[model samples]
Target: MAPTLLSSPLQGFTDFRFRNAFQHYFGGIDTFYAPYIRLNGQLKIKQSYQNDLQLENNSTLNVIPQVMTNDPDEFLFVVKYVQSLGYKELNWNLGCPYPMVTKSGMGSGLICNPTRINEVLHKAHNESDIVVSMKMRMGYENATEILDAFPILDKYPLKNIAIHARIGKQLYNGPVDLDAFEKCISGTKHKLYYNGDITSLESFKKIQNRFPTIDHFMIGRGLIADPFLPNMIKNDTKAYPKNRWEIFSEFHDRIYQQYDEYLSGPTPIKMKMLGFWEFFSQSFPNPQKIVKAIKKASSPKKYQETVASILKNV
Candidate 1:
């Protein structure tokens, strides 16, 4: 069976603009998980978050909105908001490993506390009509954290649980613990989706061979590192378009233009593009040099010139 490919949400990177452009240029992802919509203490959703989920903005793509909150009231508020916008499934972001989010007792920090997880899931499942799914790590500090929460999660009828195979404190550093993830699969009753370190066809195949029954995968940084990875995985070949550079240039240009139009100043746009280049530069040869050039670009014009030169040479 063909596996399902999901575009994992990365804050500040996989916004509506990037999603639309990616879907337009490359079409392999089965569904796109939007970045978590954060509610400030004021209970108001940011305009940028609202814009990201507007139906019109995502008409051509299947999008699942994710919410990052430990508070039940906040979860319900997001449920009603997304339901009003016509989304049928909502993903609870218990996977974010950032200290800022975890320190607030949200994201991976909440995974170790079954009481809080139970409270949120119970309220969300009973009060909302939409299906609630969870994207999470094994724990904040240790792998056993998820074991404690599994029973509470079993009590709720979640659509699915996507595990990233690492503790939150690791913060995208150390290797993903496939052994621990295998244990998680045996322990949980909900459908599972694997998310982590799938940077190449070889790695993806190894995981597929190991877990033949698992069909869903949520790719984060790897997707940015190699945009064609999903296509390669689905096609089961390393073949790429002859005009790969041309297509990639066009895709990058579109994202640049979109961010240019939305952002206020040249510095913001330059910084934003540079951030993307941090991952995107990996797709090309001499990535360090290319990233250095992009970073040295002080103005929008300079950045464009550097990108154009790199694209031409690559």
Candidate 2:
């Protein structure tokens, strides 16, 4: 059977504009998980998050709303908010590995405290009818931490637990622990979706062949690094289309125009695209050279010319 591919949420990159453009140009993702809606001490959701989850904005895609919080009240508030927006499922984020979030007892930090995890889950399940799912790292300090939490997680009727296969402290570096992930298979009653290091077709096949039971795979930075990856993986081909650069150029322009119109100054848009190219550069012949060219393009016109020149090489 063909496996299901999911686009994992990256906070600054995978917004509605990017999602829409990606789906239109390269199609393979079965669903997209919107970046987590983080509420400050207040119960209110940010306008940017609001815009991302709006039904009209996501009409063409299957999107699951996500939230990052350790507080029961905050979890419940986000639950009601997404339910109001007509989303049936809310994915809880326990996998973010940043210092700011982890220091606050949220994200991967919450994984160690299963009592708090239970508390948040308790309120969300009891107070709302919305379905609950989870996105988590194995743990913050060590891989075994999730093993301890799984008993508590087993108590809830979660949609599934998506494990990123690395501890929070690793922070996207190091190899994903297949042995640790293998242990996770028997750790919970809920379904498990694999997420981590699925950058190419060969890497994906290694994971699939190892865990024949896992059907769902989530692609995060890998998706941005190579947008055609999901579709290629779906079709099970290593060859690029004849017009690979043309399709990518069109996709890039579509997003650049949308972001340029939305962001006020030339600087913000430059930084925004720069963030994307950090990953996008990897797909090119020389990542450092491509990134250097993008970085040197100081103004909007210069940026456009630089992008054109870069694609012209292809």
Candidate 3:
């Protein structure tokens, strides 16, 4: 069977604008998981979150809205809200490792508490018609933390479980634990998807070889680092698109223009582009220099000039 490819959600980066631009410029992702719609204690979904998941805003692509919360009420609220938007599936975010999210006993931090996981799952499944899936890490503090929660998860009919094979404490810095991931396969019967350091075709091949039965994958930083990665992986081709630079330039420009129009200040736009460049710079030659040039731009004009210079050189 052909493998399923998913675009992983990165909180600050994978907004609707980026998703739309990426779909226009590239191919190979079967589904795009939107960044989590965070529900605070107020139980209110932010307008931005509502706007992001609006059917009209996402008409071009297949999208699944992800929700981050440890509360059953919040999860159910998201269920009803997204279903009202005509979505049939919702992804629960149990994978975020950021300190602010984890410290609150949400995200990966909640994995250690099997009781809480059970409560949330029971309530959600019993009360809603939404099909639930989960994106998660192995554990919050230790790699084995998921062990206790696996049995609880098995009690429900999850759409699927995508595991990023690192403990939350590592926070995307350390090597992904393939052994731990293997253990996860043995521990649960649910459909599984892998999400970790799949940065290159070779790495992807290695992972495929190791886990031959698993077919779904979620690419996060890897896709951001190389927008062409999904196409390359899907086609098993190393050749670049004939007008790769032209297409990439258009993609970047669309994102830039959208941000510029929406954002009020020069600094906000410059900073946002700079953030994207952190991953985008890796695709070009002399990435360090490219990133440095992007970083040095204090004003929007300087940023555009720096980008144009890089594009000209490329």
Best by the lDDT measure: 2
Candidate 3 at 30: error in angstroms? 0.5
Candidate 2 residues lying further than 4 Å off, grouped into runs, are: none
Model 1, span 1-314: residue lDDT tens: 77899999999999999999999998789999999998988678899999999999999999999999999999999999999999999999998888999999999999988999999888988887889999999999999899889999999889999999999999989899999999999898999999999988889998888988689998889898889889889998888889888888899999999999999999899989989999998888788998899989888888888988998888
lDDT of each: 0.92, 0.95, 0.91
Candidate with the greatest TM-score versus the true structure: 2
- Best-first order by lDDT: 2, 1, 3
Better of 2 and 3 by TM-score: 2
Off by over 4 Å in 1: none
**Model 3: per-residue lDDT, tens digit, 1-314?**
66789999998899888999899899789999999999768878899888788998899999999999999898899899999999999999999898999999899999998898888889999998889999999999898998789999999999999999999999879799999999999999998999999988999999999999899999999998899999899998788898988888999999999889978899889889988999999898888998899989888889889998898899
For 50-93, candidate 2 gives per-residue lDDT tens digits of: 99999999999999999999999999999999999899999999
